[model samples]
Target: MHSLPDVSLRYGSLQVFHSLEEYKESGVCKIPGAVTLGKFDGVHIGHQKLIRKIMDFAHANSISSIVFAIEIQDRPILSHEERAVYLESLGVDILVECPFSREFMSMRAETFAREVLSETMHASYVCVGTDFGFGCRREGTASMLADLGRQYGFQVEIAAKERLFQEDVSSSRVRKALAKGDMKLANALLGRPYPVMGIVQHGRHLGTGIGVPTVNVHPGANKILPPDGVYASCTRLPDQTIRTGITNLGIRPTVGGKTRKAETTLFDFQADLYGQTIQTDLLDYLRPEHKFSSLDELKSQIGRDRESALAILPDECDRFYGGPAFEFHGQG
Candidate 1:
């Protein structure tokens, strides 16, 4: 078991109500208003601004602030847990994370307003972006939500849409930036570096022979991989310490000719990390993967790569040592 928190009662600065029973159970609970926060991928600067408005509105109205986020939605770029973490960090009093099912997706706009917003979440207010849409092929527009709010005796706050450099800030834009390996723009829009998580898996130990040992990681199939190339990245170990590494995120044409593998050559680190989870953030692209004629040539190229990585990396490289070399041959 993951040993996670309670499914029903989620702790928050804002009292999180799950179902109608939970809402009705807590009677006379400070006007019982809530706002529907969306997928909120990256928790970008624009998202932060809108959330702040929602918090301020709820506070000024003397109502318990509720931020309703969905789980397993059709378009979620981040997990429900990740979204909850970011919201709680920003002082979201209550967070309602409900499974987005077929029933919920097919519900009428009015029913969604009544069941989700009013009955379940006990929302007296709803805040959404100007481009927000919902319910049955996305029939619930901001205008519909506003109308529903009036009908349900609640207020709807429409947050003005935001843009970065004259382009609307959106998850699609962020994905595009990441796809192009434009980390600077992506970070600027995201307000933090984008990252990928994977578990350390054992690989044919080719690095030790070259005097540079590496840990192999296969990123979760669902987790999007950045553009293929050698990247200067930071690895966050299970122990919570960050280490610098050079990552190759492409088909290993040199050694593993048939199967491509994503490998991280950690600098100055030596620990048994197999089966442990690792988070890596790409800082800069170093070079394209090149095939070498022989082991000596490959090692020479890797040495140069290490030097380049060290120079680009902020701190001194760790002179880490690990297990002995194992042979791996490319079956071309």
Candidate 2:
């Protein structure tokens, strides 16, 4: 057996254990927690309900809150790092990125529940979606988990799947919306704008020549993205400043570019951002990417894109700066 190191890393206020074995070795397992497990690909509204249940239970019982995020896909709506940030923002106490290795894939459901959930993690309460499946070949269902919870001395809470537009909110649905470049529908399902994070890289500086300097960032292979198009975007700079911009996500065929990257031009902001990580959220789809005959044509179109982006972004900035307030009603 290949043993993983006893590693526990901290992200903001959340503690992350690479695997169940690492959690046991870190000695943090001594603290009983309300636990929830899922792939949580997009951390969509459906997943948020499960997380909220565990958070409420943990807070009421004065126990730690833990999330077991199973890694099962190569291209996820959000990268593992982005998921960790979202989980931390939701106030989860710990995150375990459990690798779905062959050993784990073949493990019996009952054994997983007993060894990992009951004994090792000391889960007092467990939450999952109604359609959740686990164990080898997905032989374990929500009902099976509930039965196991009874045997293992833990309570199980099954949250119903969230629906929007009479359709179930799922990671796959989010991906489809993005693939269609339906940013509005995608963001509505996500309960937030679709975000892309990457380190700004050096480019051909074509935008500079057109008098519209831009920053370039590659979204990476593991992160799924919308179609290649120009989008009205809101970017969070390294300094934590939010700037509205127009972002083009593609190979820049107009400039004879071959690399796929997100090239963004902030409306009224300019600073050297190379080597720094920035996050851009796609707010709305402006237009599909097109090859222009000349730099002047591209520049003129970019000016029009700026105007269109300005029209849609001011309201977004208002809401973003104001933030949202949540009122939690006690579970009856």
Best by TM-score: 2
Residue runs of model 1 more than 4 Å from their true location after superposition: 1-33, 54-101, 257-261, 315-332
- Poorest stretch of ten by lDDT in candidate 2: 1-10
- Per-residue alpha-carbon lDDT of candidate 2 for residues 174-212, written as tens digits (9 for 90 to 100): 989989999888888887778887778999888998899
User: Which residue pairs come into collision in candidate 2?
Assistant: none
Candidate 2 lDDT (Cα, 0 to 1): 0.84
Give the per-residue lDDT of model 1 (tens digit) for 225-263. Answer: 467778877676655456777888877777855545568
TM-score of each model, paired residue for residue = 0.73, 0.91
**Model 2 TM-score on a 0 to 1 scale:** 0.91
